[model samples]
Target: SVEGSTGLIASLFNGIKVTQSTMSEVMALIDSSNTKLEYSSQELSNASKKLSESSNLQAVSLEETAAAIEEIASTIKQSSANAQKMTTHAQSVTKANEVGKNLAHQTVKSMDELSNEVNSILEAITVIDQIAFQTNILSLNAAVEAATAGEAGKGFAVVAAEVRNLATRSADAAKEIKAIVESATQKANMSKEVTDKMLQGYNALDDNINQTIGLIEEVANATKEQQNAIVQINDTVNSLDKATQENASLASNISVMAQNTQELVEQLKNAVSNTTYNELSKKRICDPALIFTANKLKSDHIVFKDNNFNNCGIGKNFTVKTHNECDLGKWINAHKNEKFAQTQAWNELLKVHEDVHAKVQKTVDLYAVGASNEEIFTYTKDVEQSATKVFALLDKLREINCENKS
Candidate 1:
């Protein structure tokens, strides 16, 4: 009976050891899970931050593109209006040219009629010359008859001489008038040639003007189409800008949720660490909440950095909390009497934490005053450096805490 009892007792001890070992392994798994969750949350926060930044940039670019398209549309509209005006002017010119062409035709007809009248005058002048020649011949016959009749024919001879003189003067006047008429006919022919050339030139100019009007009309039509297309493009750009802004808002929310999840995971890790079954496990499970808080702070700062101080969750009205008002600072204050607080890492952390807040306040002030992005970026670097130091110091504090707990 004693031997059986000893074996049962030994079996009971073996069972307890196994259970303790399983619990330790479970704790280790939980710790690993917590680490993985923290890492995954951080990665998600970073990704979402980048998405928000890209979306914002896309929105800005789309807005600028929309503005440019609007300007182009306006320019096209003006050009279209000008083209229409030109087309109207060209049409008016075409009408004027037609009127001029008509007038030119009338003038050409009048010149032709004048040439015909001049030709008729030349024929009449020839008839008058023949009559003068016949009269002169009749007068010579009378003179001859008078000479044959002696004294009685003397007075008739004088009247025949006077009639011959009158016929001769008529012939000279007819020749002078013919010369003037011939000169007038040559001038009329030249004028007709010039008018005909002018009429041809007018026709050619009319054709060219008509062609130009057609080209201008085509240009006007094309400009109108381009203006319509630009209007559509501007509408599309505005829609894209709206969508991008929505996307940015969504990304910002996602990043905030990811950070919240990370914080929750840290809390869960802390809760699990408190359930350790051994001193060694207790030492391994030091307070890492400050470390997680530092990580969150860094992630938040990254959001602001990535967003270029525009539309980040924090606004210009955001109050820049002092180090004492921050989570890590509060933790530090609560743990001031602790052994780790007296360490060099704690001192450095305090200094860097204050610097981080100072830089943040400066950034906010710059943003409030409408400072340039370059100026903000310069201060952002300072914040980044201080935040990095704070995180490193927090990690160091965590290590010191583990040692102190051990």
Candidate 2:
């Protein structure tokens, strides 16, 4: 009976030792879990912060894009209106050309008629000259007959001499009139030639003006289409901005939830440290939020690239934030005096961040100067690469923090 009782007590002692070993192991696991939870919570907080910032930035970008689209639409409308006005003016010019051409035709007809009349006058003058010549010959014959009659025909001889003088004067007058008519006919022919050439010029000008009117009409139609496209783009941007704002709100909520979870974890850890064995509160750890800022930055760059390629809208007047103006930049500034700032990783991050902004600025300048898309894209890629390096450096800094904490 004594041996059985000793065996029972030893067995109970072994069971107690095993139970204490299990509790120690459980406590060690709790400590490790608390550490991991703390780290995870910090990471979650940071991710949430980045997401909120990204959402805000996206909203701003969308708003600015909408404003730019509106401005472009307005400009297009103005261009359309100007094109319409030009078309109207061209049409008016064409009408004036037609009127001038008609008047030219009428003037040419009148000139031809005048030339014909001058020719008829020349014919009449020739007939008058013949009459004068015949009259002079008749006068000469009459004078010779009268002289033959001597003194009896002396009075007749005087009358024939006077008639001969009148015939000679009439012939001289007819020659002078024919000279004047021929000079006028020559001038009329030259004027007619000039009028015909002027009419031809008017025809050529009319054809060119009509072509110009057609081109202006085409421009007006294209401008109208551009305006419509811009309006649609503006609407799309507004809608996207609204969604971004909602996402920002959701991020804020998630941040709050993460903080709450962290607090609950702290309480659980404290409770576990106090009790040897008790019901551990089951704490729910939420999934980590995505780091949206990096992706959003990349997306912004892509949009800028597309704008550069398309050569439209805000692309013409693209503007970028300075490194110090971004959320990450501000965070870096806030932590400048921290231990991580003394590390090479932090310095590299700073350099890479600045390089990213510099590259973006360079691309924007290139776009402004109408650089080729390939050139601009090269710079854009540099910016994206720099941005990626900056993030990697940031992760290195976080790792440094974790090592220091350990």
Candidate 3:
């Protein structure tokens, strides 16, 4: 029994090397996990930062789009109203045209009546012309008979001559009146043709106005549909924006948890060391779930108390208690100076981005060449500067869009 107890003690005492070896493996595993967590957290933070920038840009673009749509809708409404007025005026003109057509018809009728009266006058002139010819012949026969009767026939001859002369003058006067009446009738016929053409022109004009009115009504209907579609798009963007903010928050939380887990693993590695590892099984167990943590994400609230932005004017002034969305033209007009400034700042900021990329590449190369942590720290300032520039651009964008606060 004593020999068996001594043997058991020897076996237990010799197991320390095996125990230390197993603990070394555990420490290696913990080191690997910590490395993964650090890399992932850094990547997450970078992505979240970019996403925040994208979300803000989307907000600015969406607000601009919405303001543009509202202005378009207003313009359409005004144009539609003007078209309605034009339609009313066209109807009035059509009525007046009809009245003019009636007057033209009356003029044509009067001309026809005048032409008929002229024809009657021409007929009377023809009768007088024939009578004058007969009278002249009869006068010639009486003159010859008077010459045969000498002195007794002289008085009869003079009387017959005077009668012939009076007939000739009557025929001449009738011929002149016939020529004048024929010319007047021809002019009246031309006048009727002109009046008829005027009536046709009026009818064509009325038709054109009716077609124009129909087109205006169609445009008004289309504008209404576009307004509805834009509203739907705005609602969708807002919902997506909220979801994006939630994901960013979750990423931040994961980063904190990873840092804590790395610290715990460090302690656990020390506990397994041969220097003081006799308390082996007394250590508190870690939850396996910590190795694969995932977080539930949430959105950022819009109406937070510190929701203030700098004024660079694209919409109404943020400081104003009440303001309406501005038109595209007005928004552009408001942001001209700011836009110019942004462009200049962006050029400088772009260099910062390039500089950061070069610095990071150099830092990686230095690490490979056995650079110390203190050496790596020197390059960190360049990264921080890049971050600062990005934030500055973001803040500038915020100020530009603040004027359009919903």
Candidate 4:
């Protein structure tokens, strides 16, 4: 009877175990249905938000495209006007060149006549020099004769000597006049050469002007071509503007699609969150302690300081180095090449050095005018801290940017 009771109890325990397993299976199915419903709702909400942002971006793009088309139109009009003005100026330059060439030719002819006159004067002066040479010889002979004839011939010799002296004076005057004539002749010749060269240059310039006029004509043709090209560009930009509008519309559609995808993913995420498996996955996916440690490592201590740079002209009543003779010396010696060394020295010593010193003196005076040291120190500290924070922020931003890129 005891053995029979034990068998009945075992059968009852097996039935209870089967009933508990069936109930667990039913609960899993209900949870899965709930997850699917939640995911669908979330996906719809995300899709709506994305569509709104995409629409706004498309509107902005359309406006920008229209503005760009208008700008192109204005540029084309301005370019056409400038091209016309250039063409007119080129024509005027051609006419002016022709007139200049004519004037240069007339100037050359006048210079040739002047040169002929100078040559004639030089020939007469040469003849005078030859006569003066003969006179000098005759004067020396008279002086000798006056010495040979003594006493009674002395009076007559004195007259001869006086005549000789008169001749000598005439010869000297002739020589001076010859020198002046030669100088004038040389100058005239030089002038003639210069004018002739100028005439040649003018002729060359005329030829070049003609060639340049041809080039200008070509440029005018090119300008017309450019004008036509600009017109085509305007048309192309208009077309591109229309295309951009279309692209924006397409982008809007793509954005909507992407939003819907995001929403679906979000729903899936929510659905997964509700599962025990998801909870285990989240713990495995991220370590909060590691994240906190990284954040702390990235943080920096910021400090500020401000001072009146009475000597440097940088800020308030800070006694900056007014005369940095050492800096000047260093700057002077900084140049490797000897030629640039002096220049570097002057640049450093004469330019900013003086100005900075002036500024420093001004700052000191400003601080002396009823400003307390504590107040000045506080201000200076504030300024320094502000600069430090700005640099720190910049560094942090760069790190974040680098991380994003990676």
Question: Which candidate leads in TM-score?
Answer: 1
lDDT of 4 by residue, 158-224 (tens): 7776767776677677778768867876776787678778767767876776777677567667756
Error of 3 at 335 (Å): 70
lDDT tens digits, residue span 211-268, model 3: 7767766765665666566567657756665665675566556556655655665565
lDDT of 1 by residue, 138-252 (tens): 9999999999999999999999999899999999999999999999989988988888888898899999998999899899989988987887788788788888988999998
Q: Rank the candidates by lDDT, best first.
A: 1, 2, 3, 4
Instruction: Give each model a TM-score.
Output: 0.61, 0.59, 0.49, 0.36
Give the per-residue lDDT digits (tens) of candidate 2, residues 26-47.
Answer: 5644665787887888788889
Candidate with maximal lDDT: 1
Full-model lDDT for every candidate: 0.76, 0.72, 0.54, 0.51
Count of backbone collisions within predicted model 2: 0
Once model 4 is optimally superposed onto the true structure by TM-score, how far is the C-alpha of residue 42 displaced, in angstroms?
Answer: 25
Off by over 4 Å in 1: 1-29, 275-406
Question: Mind sharing the TM-score for model 2?
Answer: 0.59
In angstroms, how far off is 63's CA in candidate 1? 2.7
Candidate 1, residue 200: lDDT:
95
**Candidate 2: what lDDT?**
0.72
